[model samples]
Target: MNALIVAPIVLPAIVAALSVLARGRRQRVGAALSLAGCVGLLAIALALFAQASGGAVSVYTVGDWPAPFGIVLVLDRLSALMLLLNAGLALVVLVHALLTGVDRKGWHFHPLFQFLLTGLNGAFLTGDLFNLFVFFEVLLIASYGLMLHGQGAGRLKAGLQYVVINLVGSTLFLIGVGTLYGVTGTLNMADMGLRIAALPTGDRGLVQVGALLLTVVFALKAALLPLHLWLPRTYGGTSPVVAALFAIMTKVGVYAIIRTTTLIFGAQVTGPLMLPAAIASVVIGFVGVLAARGLREQAAFGVVGSTGTLLVAVALFEPRALAAGLYYLPHTTLTVALLFLVADLIARRRADHGDAITPGPRFASMGPIAVLYLLAGIALAGMPPLSGFIGKLLILKAALAHQAAPWIWAAILGTTLLAVIALARTGSTLFWKGRAGEMRHGAVSRLDLLPAVALVVLLGALTVGAGSVTGFMDAVAGQMFAPRGYIEAVLGQAAVR
Candidate 1:
């Protein structure tokens, strides 16, 4: 058993508990400690990625019990990559929050933030289905506290809707879990994966229903269209820092979908059903993006659109396609974080000028900032030379190779068109046009610049190193499509079927 497998989950839990016990100035110290813990998690995740790259699986069984009887944590390429992304982003956001003095808003912020990390790490690491639910609840509860941090009627009302929708999703998740367990007689994902594949055709229908239900639950969390009514209101109404944190939150649901589909439901029977749902997500997401207005609302709709695109990538269910999905996941996460940060800066700048946004006479003023915004926006829209382009290319290649359903192409093309329109609109409104008033200079703190710079630099690095990154993604794609590696890591050779 690898000790590193559990560190990510435990470190954040301990930090959160400690933060809750601290007070006053000590709270900042607690926050620092939490940041340090996330740093440690990032280091561990990178190391695990290196280890997994050598074609080895790292497993940790909680309390020394065997798989299917005890909670298991497995580290494979996909999970390790996601762990690194999640921890890295959480660390960056925490530093941004601390530097910006957003931490001072409430004494509870540090503790809640830490708790959310704990849940995120736990969800990514856990090997049991039920444990996944528990970790999700941990994160959800923390998110509720974070969402409602500085009370206002607007925030409260929006948050209430968010909470209520998620609660329904959670209830459905429970039902899915119960049904799966009742059918398989176990909740450990690896064990269930083995057993589920062996069930007779008639009996497998229940498992399919359960899997679809779970997909719906995660889609709600990912804020896919039709189920995404609460995202804009909730995220737009929250504090900018919190909204940045949420940029990662929605991806967690995407992560769950990817993990569940590729790992637990990749059997022939279940894979087909998932394809249709993925197509629907893509179509709806694109439409939402086109229909949105305003900066925040547009970004919110972009979130839905991006989710759809990624889902389509996954639905393609080919090595190249899944690789593209994995690659795009972190890219989208980083881009969204940067976009939200930009929006926050824009809003702050507007507020400084007596709540009126007026651009200076120089059309090229703020060129550097505008470039950063354009790069991020274009990347989100899948323009050439960006990470999104590379990701989409891989998916397109895979879809053509596999001769996927006709609707797959239709959805992909429609989504691309809508994304173009949406991003074009954002560019024209946010960068091209100037408002009629004096330009006011708000205090652009280093805190604000830190996350923006970090995200932009990260995107640039990915773009420049696309070849090597795509190679790594290819390896991850191979491993994910063949579940033997993950299963063997979590459950020893004895459990391999």
Candidate 2:
């Protein structure tokens, strides 16, 4: 169990080091090795999940040190589930990158990808708040390299904005952490959680302020509403494969928000205040989507809106609601990645013939591709029988059970309508219209087709198995809310009660 907790973090780091040392043909070999590492991490995550399903928690202390003094990795049901999702997504993206010849273009890509995985795995497993921040920085640095990976003017320009915004967020994160340490005198999350529960009511205000700052930092990363101005531009400028890799990055921010709200501030001062903010994000995100006429831009805004919806579910803080949020998390991540990849495929095909990939009047003529676009559009809009529908239904049911504010209901309805209209407009321009110039036909490479097919198949699987997945998500949610199992594993029985 201890090795399982450490494997996800250590395996990636080891592979990344190997990737950095490899050259030429060995680079591809390095990439293969990295993929193998990801597979190992995925298996370990699954095993952790199985073990945690018995309502137990597993803890691993680095360098054989104890909690609060030594760095600790804790895996309960929530962490195990998130680790599995991250590893799976990383594996798929890595495979897509190799199949598309991205690794062949640059030696650095594989190492950076592996390092990014290292950060993600570490972030999910860490029981220390400061260590979580350190992992976040590691991930951010690797992302900076990946975002700038082809080194073009557009990429650099976009990367600058991405880096600048995240740097500010990172600074704020540090300040928040410092403030938290000052107040609680501890950086271990489980220890902090216990201490926080015992703090005098008056001093809770200081902790709430610190939590709010941390929330802002994470919300910025999640690209929620006003903080999202950087996302569409950044993602729009990057290559499709890089954009796909980033699909999980933004979700990591949302994941942090969920973890913090549930474990650290559960039913505390931070949860209630976040609800209205979540509603505002939902409204703002949908409006942004409606305002975007371009396909790439629209997809970017849709990502924002979906993230906002998930955050709202988190803020609701009901067991069923958090369960809905958990279910929605993976669903949105997969859908967004697929949509971005599909957009890239269609655009690349257009570019091959010296035609504009950006949707114009000419795109309406591509009927077969148009169907794919429509399916993605429908899925994004939460249409029935899709995974999106299942996620949204769970959230709506929970919202009703809680009898949430009328404005929240209004925001959800309004956002859905706007998202539908925005997607329809983008689809019509890209798929339904015809360009004025001569049409050129080009072969769709298997590289492109493979990702699209895999995405569709995965979505289909999710749709068919939504019942079982939701049940698992619900169980994880229950584990997260109480988290006594997690506390015991990290601090032993002496520290828990």
Candidate 3:
């Protein structure tokens, strides 16, 4: 179990190093190595998921040292589920990148992709705040490189914005960590939780401020409300494959919030800050989607709206409600990524027109790509017979018992309606309408379409298997809410008490 826990992190780092070593003329070999790493990661993630689904928590202590001191990695149901989702996404996106010939655009694409995987896997597994921050930096730096792989003025500009915003967020992360260490005299999450539980009332204000700062940083990464200015522009500007891979990046912030609040800070502070921010994000996302002039921008805003809806349930801090949110997480992530890839596919066919979402050239082999975009649009709007519908249903049903049930229902349902309208507009303009000028009949490669097709099929599978998945999520929720077991795993048994 310990080996499995450590393998996901180490495997990627090793592959990344190998890929980097195979630089220049050996870049083809590097891409192949990265692809192999992605496959291995998917297998390892699935194995971990299977192990954790049995309601066990696994821990790996670095350097054979004890907890609250040495580096530690912990895997419970939540982390395992995240690992599987991330690995699956990365694998599919890598295939898409290879198909699109984007992997060869720069010498470092393969190595950077592997390094990004290393960081993502590490962030999910790390049990301490310091290492979490370390993993975040690793991923961010790799992302900066990937974002600029194609090297356009627009992309470079967006990359700069991304770097600047994240640097500020990273600064806040360090400040929060420093304050946390000063207050609790520990960097270990479980130990921090124990200390926080017994915190002196006089110091509560100081700790709260520090925690709030951290929350803001995570929310920024999560793209909650006003902080979300970077998302649509950044995502829209990046290469389609890179954009698809970034689908999981935002969720890193979501993961941090879940792990830290439930395990360390409790939801008392989080709920208050997150609630209003989520509502605002929902409003802004819907507005942006409605206002979008292109398919890519609309999809970017669609992602933001979905994030808000996911966080709405999460902010409530109800176990069942959060399980619903958890279920929604992977579904939304995959759907949004599929949207990005499809947008790029359609845009590439149009060439200079570039997914304008207005009447344009009818793509050759329009049947498959058009069908995909249509279905993805429906799913993104939370329409019936898809996982999106089921996910929203779960969230709404769980929210019905809350005091603010009406607000929750009205807000979610209303924004979903707007989302439908926005998607409808995009679909009609892109696929249905015909343009005046001579159409560019660029041949659409079936290989480029394969990954998106697989994602759509998986969305269907998720819908059909909702019952089993939700049950597992319920069990995972049970493990998540009570942190004693998690605390004891890192510390000795009864150490937290």
Best candidate, TM-score: 3
TM-score of model 3 vs. true structure: 0.98
Model 2 has an lDDT value of 0.78
Off by over 4 Å in 3: 435-439
Return the clash pairs for model 2, or none. Answer: 361-434, 362-434, 362-435, 364-431, 364-432, 364-433
RMSD of each: 2.8, 2.6, 1.4
Give one digit per residue, the lDDT tens place, for model 1 in 202-321.
Answer: 888899888888888887888765687788788777776787778878877877877787777763544665566667767776676666654565566667667777877776667888
What is the alpha-carbon lDDT for the whole of candidate 3? 0.88
Off by over 4 Å in 1: 267-277, 352-365, 402-410, 435-437
lDDT of 2 at 433: 70
Question: What TM-score quantifies how close candidate 1 is to the native fold?
Answer: 0.92
Give me the candidate number with maximum lDDT: 3
Model 3, 1-497: lDDT tens digits are 37779999999899999998887888889888998999999999999999888877899999988898899999999999999999999999999888888888888998899999989999999999999999999999999999999899999899999999999999999999999899999999999989988998998887887788888888988999879999999988888789889988889999898899998888888787787788778778877888899877888888798899889888989789889999899999999999988987888788867878788766655678889988898888899989999999999999887777787788788988898888888887877785645556765577788999989988988899999989988888888898788888889896955
Model 3, residue 177: C-alpha shift (Å): 0.8
CA lDDT of each candidate?
0.77, 0.78, 0.88
